[model samples]
Target chain A: MPKSEFSRRKFLGFAGTASGLVVIAGCNKDEVVSPGTLDGVDLGSGDIGILNYAYALEQLEAAFYTQVIMTQFSGISSPEATLLTDIRDHEVAHREFFKTALGDKAIQDLEVDFSSIDFSSRDSVLATAKAFEDLGVSAYNGAGRLIETADYLVLAGKIVSVEARHAALIRDLISPGSFADDTVINSDGLDGSRKPSEVLMIAQPYIKTVINGANLPTY
Target chain B: MNLSNIIDEIEKADGEAFDRVNSRRSVLRNFAGVTGKAALAALPVAFGSLFKKAYAGTRGVQDVFDVLNYALTLEYLEAEFYVQSLLAPGLLSGQLAMSIQTISKHETAHVNFLKAAITAAGGTPVDKPGFDFSGGKGSGDGPFKNAFSDLGLFLAVAQAFEDTGVRAYKGRAAELLGGEAVTTAALQIHSVEARHAAHIRYMRQQLGSGVGNLQPWITGNMSGIDSELVQPSYNGEENTMQASVEITGINGFEISAESASEAFDEPLTPEQVLAIVDGFIV
Candidate 1:
């Protein structure tokens, strides 16, 4: 079967057995069930849930960039290669930072399905990068209100700006002066924001792991 | 001032002050006895009213009004710089002109939005201060005298302003935390400023004339521009410690200091931001 179809089947299987796995885990009080043992990973609740949500997205971005550098799009210029490599390193650092911060609460490594992306083609690679960076910015923006801890909010603030920076550069790479174009930035000059549920739905196709964001705080 | 006298002063400034204060106090009183999801649900309303009280000139409180006014001042500086740059003859052509025009519109939009928000919150918007883009402090001839005439110098100054704007907003985000609507709006605008900063950095990279090896993201507190005038904007940006965790070489990822710093943008205190911006403000 094709990779996309296979991932879809896997996701459906996880969804079907999600409830059963939760009940099983509940009965085993002393057993420390690993994240991998569950059919779907629950992002936990409150701040941990939000951090895991961020970690999951970072994992997808880091994985994508690693692949981009390894394959290298056809006819990539030296300048482009250098910048893309920098972006990959930044994403890797971000992913690791969240993982380390979350410690035991961090979700297992998410399996990404990038079958839809043509990594060898510049257009395909850049457009996907743009989407991920934009989505990342919006996710942080929306999640900021949900963060109760001031330090966590500030941390989210620190990272969201970098994601915005990445989004702008990727947009410019596609079109010279379209960095803050109207599509992402509204007429009021505000960048877009997306709730976790909305963002997760959009990101579902790219991620093979079934992410349960039901416990995330929403306002 | 005494308590009653202060209350009278606030009432004179805002007629609805007492009503808002009472309602907010009642909410808090009710919330005090309650717990769980219900209290959480009413947080935004309580926070909103609390912010409104702060706007009514509540002493000793750094309210949302102060933050918005601070932002408005910065927006005015940016909006006017772009407006004047576009009007300058023999400067800004082709893609560079287009990018500046796009950024200019956003700055203007931000100015308008902030003014409206302040007004809606029962606070008078601060007047737009006169800006001498040449960094003259009203002298009309400072380090960036050719800011409008020379494209390179213009971009360097623009990059400084955009980077400062991003840092300034990031610094104040925590102040608006409980007020969800304002917090979300500020975050939205904060990201837009970052986008503008990145685009300006990209332009500098493309120019590559007097500008140093500039990347879209800041690297190691190094002001991509060689001049010391713009160095303040990049100060403290070299920080690799986040939430008390030293990011460099953490988790054995071989993450370089530059990459670690680049992954997270540092916040500049309001005083720090004002000091940098005061140079251009007449």
Candidate 2:
């Protein structure tokens, strides 16, 4: 059996014996909480947890782009507008893909906190888009090693490259010829990667939901 | 011939051959006890199970080393392409030249990093292969012979190489999964290649010679170049089914097939990539 399936069964076994709440001990003595509690949503465990993590990010990206298009930042050019629209559609597609793939295991729709983002200004919107795209790419890159299923790893690979492509375009729009600049691509010619804990902490301000990623695998 | 005799002959040709073999002994350790033809006959199944076990947890050290070497070869090609392009007088200038220069630097870095990684892993880095860049198989008279002289052709070929690099790295990702540090490094490189691909595509879109209307991402399986020589790089990219999920109209949304295909980049097998790359290799 795949490691993910085996771990899911083990997690369910714990859930089965517990009362209303199940607080299992994590690898590093952290408390691994269950989902749908007052503490907020737990991303579950194993492959499902990773999928939900991706889903949550995609939700934020999709919502941000949807609002961007609805407001249509002032002075947006036709090409820029068209590109953002395409990105919005792609984000929505990615969001739906994870939801469908996860099925009953999928997490609930995430509430976004976009108050700090001024969608009216082109600079704000593009900069935020650039941050999200780079974060998404790094998140997937770091998470690849944690995935046990070959198919899921391949699927993530498929999506991450698209996210990278979106990142480059957004960066270019901000500063021409800055697509693969030193800020993201390192001295070794490799892009940066962020652990789930690091990624979620950075993403917490933009997200309203408290995500318990304690059960997610770590490298 | 006796094994000892063969080893002696190899050592004569290459002084570091034993060290190279010893570095990968972990992968060959199991073969030490099996010598008979019967044991050899059963070796295939044993090797399969061995690899399967390795895939389940940590991959073999040699596997990671080999993948790095493969990546190093491609980086050599890309680094040389950009290096030669920048050397060509009046080939590129302004923003285009700057962008190409940035990409060139990254490729050179990739080559150096991969070489260091292979050396660290006790494997000799593969020598940089000679390239034609014209798809002429070293005859220097291929269809893209004027790639350096003409800006339009340079961008087109650049697009092809970057896109191919993205797909090629992705295809080999599964092998590096269990090796955490290497997996992360390869993925980091993979996405950077995607960024390069997208930027090159944008450059091509702006040029509008034959690649006008080209999205930064691949639309379908279209190479966007109309050249059969580079078509293999884009073949199978139109795939919309990922992990058996049909991306088009999933979740009851009216998503077009083109958009669905565009949202995900497909991988090209090593053989497929090599076939496309061989045209430019001598």
Q: How many clashes does each candidate structure show, in the order listed?
A: 0, 0
- The CA-based lDDT of model 1 is what? 0.78
How good is the docking of model 2, by CAPRI class?
acceptable
lDDT scores of the candidates, listed in order: 0.78, 0.76
Q: Per-candidate TM-score, first chain only?
A: 0.83, 0.84
lDDT tens digits, residue span B1-282, model 2? 222232233233322322333323322222211112232454443322333354454655556656777788789999999999999999999999999999999999889777655554445566776788888877899888999998887888999999999998888877776655566678888899999999999888777867746888998888778677788888888888877789899888777888898999998887787777876877
Weakest 10 consecutive residues of candidate 2 chain B by summed lDDT: B27-36
DockQ: which candidate is best? 1
Candidate 2 ranges beyond 4 A from true positions: A1-38, B1-58
TM-scores of chain B alone in all candidate structures, in the order given:
0.80, 0.80
Please report the interface RMSD of model 1 to 1 decimal: 5.9
Candidate achieving the largest lDDT:
1
Query: Model 2, residue B169: what's the lDDT?
Result: 89
